[model samples]
Target: MCEEATVSLADVVQEDEQLQEEASAVLAGSDSERCSYPQGYVKRQALYACNTCTPKGGQAAGVCLACSYKCHEGHQLFELYTKRNFRCDCGNGKFADAPCKLFHAKDDVNGLNKYSHNFFGEYCTCRRPYPDPEDQEDDEMIQCVLCEDWLHGRHLGCDVPDHVESWEMICEACMNTHAFLWRYAARLAGKRRENVLRDLTDPPASDPVPGAAVESDAAKETTADETDGATEPSRKRVCPEEAEAKPGCGLEALQNAGAERPGSGAVFWPPGWRSRLCRCDACQASLAAAGLSFLPDESDTVLAYEKKGRSEEGGAPGHDPLMSALDNLSRVQQLEIIHGYNDMKSELKDFLQGFVAEGKVVTSADIRQFFERQQSRKRRRADDRFHCA
Candidate 1:
């Protein structure tokens, strides 16, 4: 016989709590009340694309969170997640019919904002939307830290590594565009992607993997045995002993390096890899030339922006007080309490709806008066019961 799925009260409550947390994380860096246009190119903020205004094959555009709610309400929107150095493009020559309700003034165009395929409600290498109807496999998509574009695991050109939370992924497109990163991959990123790059490069049959550096403080020389994936008949590679003195030598070694191999695949760089990048004068110039000056700045990261948002909102609730209090009661008592709570919540919502229908603003004094009326009704019921007894 088939069995019915059962869920305990604690399990239900925990699932609801988890859902709330996920929502909070997704909205951590978004401001829903005020327009972000005045900010002028925010380092990082949650963004949305309006298909109703700029549909597929049209000029791509994105708007800030507040614009999504106040201006693009009832319109189809694609959540672009957190984008770096983005400015709101709502009603800025892009939306001729939709004037922003929150902010009046706007430039004809936000020249700095970059738009990708995601702006038109498309994603992944396949260019399909999330929860795609054509796709049957239940694969998860991951956002590239550099491009901010989401890609399915199958399209990443490498196996998704375990414990992905501990590292940040840079897609192959970004990796090849800023090829210097490949020089650091062997030392800082996971072996999976690095191995792919090595296979594509096909370094001098049995020669040590190019750009693979030995991490040490005292060792002056490194043999092929010390390098990752290096085989026997090992060749000795000389490098600076002091870690501080190594960046120049390392970068110089790869100065004459040929064109970076395409399809090297996406690489998962471990934590602290950003700080480990060579910040020497030559490297800095190279970064600037490639328009990746923000790469070294921690403040430019999405995590940092989300943290700022959480701090401004006084942080997410650590625990629900009502849930904690309910834990002390029996299951029957818990159910009764929850039922009462639900009735009150529903009634209160309906009460508020009356004011909303009349376009009336709810105030603190109004809430106090509401509770006072409830108390008076309870007293009248008690008096009627006393008289009957």
Candidate 2:
């Protein structure tokens, strides 16, 4: 059995806040409009800083690279230069209201946040940032369609162990898309398709394993160009009630979709999509019984309608309608959670990137180990603080 992880109150609040803020960002368009991105994504700059936040120290501007994600999340931030020598402004000047939330060592190792930082200026075989007038080459650097980062011909695809064997690369930001899609496709006709996926990262094996649906992140990524990540949905987002009304979520409908088609007898919808795309009460109960969670539909149409509905109708005043549940969701399950269980999975995945990104035999043990590692990290961090103090 998978290590059981459940949701708690704190998790719900955090996710609610995040969802509301994201909704606000989408509806009102915060500083996001002025934000410059790597085509479809955002690139970090050492000089980038957010003027928001209630100056913890006395600082309002000049935020440092180390404290950006923590200090500037959901804020309108701007970028300046690429100075490498400038020190972090986290605890100095008007910013001294409190210690840096990211790094506890105020003086050691320059107190920086490197965990999520993208430390790249340029990429490709040429090794220069894009639009270099000095190079004058028409051949361009490969820009990843997922993360939108420019990549070197050899160093593309994923960051650590990602299969970097192709120019049409889909970065890690969207690697999960293919995993979920594979699962859906496998159950499409209620049959497991053998070797439906091929690994793009590794050289071809003479006699590969038969019926292998998952290859690796690199293999899953071959389907990324046509698929969308959790944040980017290609279909209309509907309520859970709406989803059950369709096929897949309901067992009978699922069987119907899988029923034999005489030269395409029935127009079958993709399997598991009913649950994957719904957020209604009925779908919530169904997924709960199956030990799964709701991955809310985030299509623009859905977001817009929700924003409008919330504005006009308001939330359940006294009921506090149960807002779905998620545990150690299958990686192939695209339901993105916000806190506790949702966040626990993310933290664990971050810790065990190597394990999570391995070839497609991700088992319940893999999921259990992921959670165990998270507990170990937390305990280790607490121990270090006690020893240092």
Candidate 3:
């Protein structure tokens, strides 16, 4: 019984394979010798209806076969066993499959050709032939003035509704120049107007009206009062809002005002806790006058003493050291310092050149030793002055 069952299954599978082959042949319209099925019998299974049956008309015809659907036309099949494609005859009407031109026609072009249309009507080409210039429907092309590239008149910012005989095109660069100049001229005009307003608001001091004693006498009295005030003492000018808004302006303004006062010749000192914290030039000078030569512990004190010594020696305070260092630096070294160390290896070459030009042996050790000696001397002098003071 098992052997007979295996043989039966094999026969059934063979029959199914034959049926599938026949169905495929019918669907493909390949069996030219075989007649189509009868009116009552189904020929090819209704995978989809024709394009006329769908709401999208022929637009979605290609997509219809992917849907699992059948026509209710009751299996009336027209004969397809010939070279021509077969049609379905039913209650709806006769519906034919789309023609296969490659197989049936003699000189059919492939859809891949540039001139050929796809299954859809979209044109696919790199270069389409230009239309005649004289044609009424043809679009006029404008050549760019600067670049000489052709563009449609509509694209060139033309106002005309229809194409004209003569069309001109200006490239973007030329357009940008015109726009920039217009804006610059408008800005200059605005600045000129602002200057005129400022001049009108503030007249010069010498422009007094002639034969006007009231104005002249008042001006003289004001000048005399100002001169008398200057002899007495100078007052500090402060804006209340600015003083309040900024952190140290109020205190600085007060100090400046006190310095300018007649009787308050007492020097101002920065506020600090200890007696040794005073670091103004006046304080440092007083310390020096009283036989004090030691450097103060604080940096501010050292700076103050240095500035006082430089000033007394008739040199500009804080200027000589910086200028001397800069003068010693070569042009390339100056550029390297300004540009920073993006390429350190390249900058090191320039640094070495400057180092050799300083009339000293150029070595890493020598450079380090020179700076070390300078720092040691400065520290020793500061310590000695502090002890002596």
Candidate 4:
């Protein structure tokens, strides 16, 4: 769309010229030949002039051309072109052909007080005095410690006292320090809560008693194997003090017991412990060093288990297989939770079909490239629309 409506600059210039000519005629005459007013008389109609005759470049005078009120006394009004001195009997004298001081005075007081109209008194035009500097300083000075912006003292929330021995300003640096300290305190509190939860679920190991005992048949089989070996199977065990001993029988026993345990039946006591520990920095670092990282299947299983646990605690009876599948979800898989298992499965199948059709592997880079292409297409479409319009 076009920003501005069509208009000819020539029309505006013509109107301005007409107004200027009318103003000039009203303010015409040499300074010595200008009209005069009685002492203390004020003008009834305001005087105006073109910018060409004004010192500070204004189009109008504050003083009236018809009467003697000091309308332009303190403002930068356009100079009067009268031959005689057109003095203001309101006591400031003639300012006909001179640059008006009304504008400068207005700037000094910021146009808040009616200095020109009231002459610095309450409805008293005969008086002429400037505002007290001490009052201005006390009322208008306030230093902002943060932005260093000066404001009126009365505008500040904290009012000034009668006497201040030592005023400590809270600078921006100090404010930011306070903010950072609060944020750090909140983070520390969260960590401490997490630690407390962990400690409650998994108490410190008091004494390391060997796990569940091996069955008698397993023991007999081991004994028989040792006896049948030619060199007695080297029954020597590695003690803490031993340097060159064989691996411990206890280590072999533990490994055998772990192998015997049913994978599906294995239960983590406080639940969610594995999820927390697995994602921990220390565990991740250790896994990376061992050349193992989390896989999609493992992540899915973990998420499924977590969801099931939450459901069970929330009063849902028995294990839901759908929730179990959800428990083991990877980060991407969790996004599907919003649509439920059946819907997610359907969506995934459709997505996979599309991938196969395109002979492309869906990846982060592919998604980013697609988004960029779409944005470029939108820009092109917009440009086409604009050009056609």
Candidate 5:
């Protein structure tokens, strides 16, 4: 191999381990041997969409991890990572020719489940397929917590914050739909532009505009500079203090206070922002009415789901399969095996690179053929050495 083409064994091993951990994080919460249909509207699970069964522009459908393995083995599938409140749609009339082998009986449709362009392998406002063949930009995609749609960071209509895993995002479409969320957004939003938001939240004190609204105690305490060197006369307000003491009082105060909503853009909320949501009866009712009762649930976040997956898998970084196989071998056999592995790695990788670069699926037969070719090459080299001797 050329110098540029050569890769370090440690680098290859590290990359392989990283890929295994990522796969485990995604699939740990799922069962590949049994159908999840019996679970009934699972809170969260890894899901797949079969392109062969539910083609683009047709009725969108998603299958659970087990169904993807058992029922749609040879079909082209799109890995959707994870989805919330989803029921597997493997054989429930969506697949014209295929019936789920694992779960034969299922409702015709999961009425509560929602489908999006992502199910059809399209994502972002650009509506491009993930790993797009035409596009070369390797921008990261962020999933909206509300709509569960993946969008490219640049198309999110706002700057994506650093340490993205530390925060959650609600896309612009969801933000507009759930405009009531903006009322609580002041506490969490615009951390990057706190000065701008502060200007809006705390105005400069001028000759008191007659009958100016009383500021809520929930508002940030103003600094001397914020007051512009003039102490405004304290105006008594009924809900100002109560807003902090009562669970839903802040939401109520915002409604009554007629505070202007924040400008349009995606909102990034810090961890535990859910705990800050008002849980009072009226707020709960409003949340339920809007089908967002899950907002207050910390478990609904993708990070939480991935954490659950990791935990279920014993939270191990990974186990080296080759090392495990070598454990029972003698020292001489182990050395021989390691030598064979070193020889196989480069040749096998070069052979597979053609299939990967061409975006072709490598079948079991292809793997078997590669091994047979390697054995043949080894035998020929042995015969040549014997003849020279």
Candidate 6:
């Protein structure tokens, strides 16, 4: 459905009572899938699962959403899902209304929290945990779109565009490889842009070599400026031929990192970028030795799914829900202990096998009255025995 179907406030209130009554029956054994809620214990709604109660060898059991905080709050949860076709088990023998075990969300039961890089409790190039509220306050971390690694604001240097609103961000390695195309993409147009992204890549004229020598005139002016406390006007530029042929430099080999040489005619940027992040042999060797890449994947952060995917909306507003909170007594035991079970079950089975039976409404209060009457009879019998003696 598109929008949330608006529900009437009065109708919801009416349903609330029926919902509880129906839910109680389901927990008591009307629903075959659930054992019934233990007698005398009424429960709230069902919308969350408790991974802590998962049997060592059996299926996981669930309680109501409120029970998460009310009962199993500190216990590791199964990332909360809608309790479809199931009943709440709170206050039942299985759940027994245990107090929630958690003091904080971050202190999840083992494997309870989503796992990924964050499982190690550290992220990004800075190797810090996502800023915890318990620790001192800190800056927000930005995730790189291409590599999917998180980084603090200061570590990424000053290359990210200040006005980036639509386009995704890449790591330094990817930006270096695709900088040429990103800069002059409109100028390159169709085939030329592809070619540039693929092969015959140009060296960045803008980047300065770490240790290139300066011309004598420029060096002389620099010394004079230092002595006079004046600044030099401009620096000399290296011609294209000299840069391309810089002894150990390999402008031609960069084509392999970026594109097919001639007949093969395959593109390389995206694929190359991924292999490099995975530390494939060619990418590792090329990047490690030469500080460059072919190109990188637009979305390299596949690990996000394992961590964030579980936390998506667990349930939505709906007219119907599930509840089944029952005890696990043997049939003979239930027969001996619960005089009303047989009667309740027979009536429960007739309504399309659902929980709500006709006429009688059984809530926790009814069970309380039944026990009170039994105790009252016991006291009267003791008075009669004393008089006879």
- Candidate topping TM-score: 5
Residue-by-residue lDDT tens digits, candidate 6, 1-389: 69855544344547997776444432322222332232212221224455566433333445544555556657666432221223454443444334333222211222221222432344566666555455465654555543444565556653333322212335454455544323222222123122322222232543222112212232232223223344334434554455435443222333334532222111112211221122235434655454333223222222212112222212323322211222566777656545555544454345322223233444567557656865787689779999999
The CA root-mean-square deviation of candidate 2, after full C-alpha superposition on the true structure, stands at 27.2
Clashes (candidate 2): 14
TM-score of 1: 0.67
For residue 100, model 5's alpha carbon misses the true position, in angstroms, by 0.5
Instruction: Give the higher-lDDT candidate: 3 or 4.
Output: 4
Residues 107-188 of candidate 1 have per-residue lDDT tens digits of 8889988889999988987889987898999988898988888999989998788756545789999998877777666544
Displacement of residue 249 (Cα, Å) in model 1 is: 6.2
Write out the backbone clash pairs for model 1: none
Candidate 5 error regions (>4 Å):
1-5, 192-248, 256-261, 315-389
Name the top lDDT candidate: 5
Q: Per-residue lDDT tens digits of candidate 4, residues 100-154?
A: 3322121111121111222111111112212333343445332222222233434
Candidate 4 Cα errors over 4 Å, as ranges: 28-87, 90-389
What tens digits encode model 5's per-residue C-alpha lDDT throughout 61-165? 999999888888899998888998899999998788788899889888889889999999999889999888898887899989988889998888888887676
Per-candidate clashes come to: 0, 14, 5, 38, 0, 21
- Report the CA-based lDDT of candidate 4 relative to the real structure: 0.32
Q: Which of the two candidates, 1 or 6, achieves a greater lDDT against the reference?
A: 1
Residues 1-389, model 3: lDDT tens digits: 56532233335446898775444433432222222222222212222323243322233121111121233234222211111111222221122443322122212222211111111221112112234334465555543322223344444432432222211233343435333212212211112222322222232333121111111222222223223234423323233342223332222323443322222111111111011112344535654664332322221232222223334434324433433666678999977654543344454555556644553445568557655865787699789999998
lDDT, residue 94, model 4 = 26
Comparison by lDDT, 3 against 5, better one: 5
lDDT score of residue 5 within candidate 6: 50
User: Per-model C-alpha lDDT, please?
Assistant: 0.70, 0.37, 0.31, 0.32, 0.74, 0.37
TM-score of each: 0.67, 0.24, 0.13, 0.15, 0.68, 0.24
lDDT of 6 at 109: 25
Candidate 6 wrongly placed segments (more than 4 Å): 1-117, 134-138, 145-147, 159-166, 172-389
